[model samples]
Every structure is written in structure tokens, then in C-alpha cells.
Target: MADKLKFALALALVAAGVVGFYLLGEQPLVLRVLAVFAGVGAGVGVAALSAPGRRFIDFAREAVVETKKVVWPSRKETVQTTGIVFAFVVVLAIFLWLTDKSLEWVLYDLILGWK
Candidate 1:
């Protein structure tokens, strides 16, 4: 129940920031942007006090750690893989075009006796 209220308050804070941005139309652009950021920061702070927020924080930490363990493909390997994909696509396109032309020849010239 308390967590839900906290979430609701956070949402209200963010909404207030957006409203302030529009209302401060005559104000400086930086101040208007800051208002939204301040609202979002405050809202996040409030929400982080809740159970779900803590879990989300934990999950984000875990995701960052897991990402560090990833082995990214080297530039050379990436280029080679891209080249292979392009070659395959080109070959497939030629094959399909030949098949279409062959089918048209059979249907129009042989079957219908029309040049």
C-alpha cells in the first residue's frame, strides 16, 4: 500500500515537471528543462524507496555485470560475416530471378503457344 502511494507520488512529480515546462514558456530553455529533470529526479528518489524500485535497481546492476562478461565480435570478424551475408543474398536473388524467367517461358511460350 505504501509502495503504491510512493509510485503514484513519483508519477505526479514527473507530470508536474512537464506541466511546469509548458507553463514556463516565456522562461529560459535551460530552466524549463531543469524543471523537468528536477521533477523526474525527485520522482525517482521517491519511487526508489519502494520494494519494486529496489528490485529494479538490483536487476539493472545484474544486467550491467552480465554485459561486461560478453565477448563482442572483432571488426575483422564483423566485416567477414557481413560480406558472407551479402554474397548469399545476391546469389539467392539471382536464383529467384532465373526461376521466375523459366516459369514465364514455360507458361507463355510452351503452354499457351504465345511468344
Candidate 2:
């Protein structure tokens, strides 16, 4: 299929860029950036040519549209949730640190008999 060929060509381009990055050691920064871009373009082009890629693109577009229709949380709700998360994180961190210290003390002092 034509799609297969395009995919193969894109893969080839990406492979060439990877190889070039290692081989073309003294190339200018601009050239290197261009090579990387070319590789990415080739991959996207190949994916575009494939049926699955088209399906994925369509699904992604629909998801974005749906996301736009969402009613996001208000500022107050966002702040409260963020504060709660921060407090939980701080508490969890202290708990973990205490646990780690207790384990270390037990292992080094009691089990191994090391001061």
C-alpha cells in the first residue's frame, strides 16, 4: 500500500537522522535542529498516511472538543483542593522520613550492632 511506503520512508528518515546525530559531529546547531525537525516531520507524515493514525487523530480531535465543553472547577474550589493536596504531601513526607529513620536505626544499631 502507498501508506506502507510512506511509513517506511518516514521511518528511514528518522533512522537516518539518528545515525546522522552520531556521525555528523561538527554540524552547525541550525543544521542539527533542522535534521531533528525533518525526522519528526517524516514520522508524523508516515502516521498521517496510515489508517490507524487517521483514526487516532479523529479521536484526539473529538476528545479536545469534549474537553472544551467541560465545566472546570471554580477558583475557590481549585485553591481549596490545592491547599489540601499540599498539606497531605507535607504530612506524607514527614511520615516517610520518620519511617526511614526508624528502619535505619533498627537495622544499623539493633540488628548489625553498629553504633
Candidate 3:
């Protein structure tokens, strides 16, 4: 119940910030932008107090940690893999083109005598 209230308050805060931005049409751009940022920042702070919010933050942190631990391919390995992929793609394209031409020849020249 408390968590739901917190979430709702957060959403309201964000909406208010957006509304304020539009409402302050005659105001300076800096002020309008500041209003939006303040609202969103406050909303996020409120939301972060909720159970689900905490879980999401934890998940995000863990994701960053895991991403950092990843063994990314070196430049050489990346280039080699890319070259292999391009070669395979070229070969496949040629094979497909030959197959299509053979089918077309069989249908038009041999069977229908249209060519």
C-alpha cells in the first residue's frame, strides 16, 4: 500500500514537471528545463523508496557489474570474425542468385518456350 502510494506520487511529480514546463511557456528556457529536471529528480527519489524501485536499481547495478566483467573481443578477433561473416554472406548471395537463375531458365526457356 505504501509502495503504491510512493509510485503514484512519483508519477504525479513527473507529470507535474512536464505540465509546469508547458505552462511556463513565457518563462526562460533555463527555468522551464530546471522545472522539468527538478520534478523528474524528485519523482525518481520518491519512486526509489518503493520495493520494486529498489529491486530495479539493484538489477541495474548488477547488470553494470556483469557488463564490466564481460570478456569483449579484441580488435583483431573482431575484424577476423567480421571478415568471415562478410565472406559467408557473399557466398550465400551467389548461391541464391544461381539457384534463382536456374529456376527462371527452366520455367521460361525450357518449359514455356517464352525466352
Top candidate when judged by lDDT against the true structure:
3
lDDT by residue (tens digit), candidate 1, 1-115: 9999999999999999999999999999999999999999999999999999999999999999999999999999999999999999999999999999999999999999999
Candidate 1 — which pairs collide? none
Q: Tens digit of lDDT per residue, candidate 2, span 1-115?
A: 8777777877888887777666666988778777777787778878776887788899999999999999999999999999999999999999999999999999999999999
Output the worst ten-in-a-row residue range by lDDT, candidate 1: 41-50
Clash-forming residue pairs, model 3: none
Sort by TM-score, top down from the best? 3, 1, 2
Per-residue lDDT tens digits of candidate 3, residues 1-115? 9999999999999999999999999999999999999999999999999999999999999999999999999999999999999999999999999999999999999999997
Q: Give the TM-score comparing model 2 with the true structure, all chains together.
A: 0.66
- Cα lDDT, all candidates: 0.97, 0.85, 0.98
RMSD of 2: 4.2
Instruction: Give stretches of model 2 more than 4 Å off.
Output: 1-5, 89-115
Distance from true location, Cα of 61 in model 1, Å: 0.4
Winner of 1 and 3 under lDDT: 3
Q: Candidate 2: worst 10 consecutive residues by lDDT?
A: 16-25
> How high is the lDDT of residue 91 in model 3?
100
Model 3: residues with Cα > 4 Å off, grouped in runs: 27-31
Count of backbone collisions in candidate 3: 0
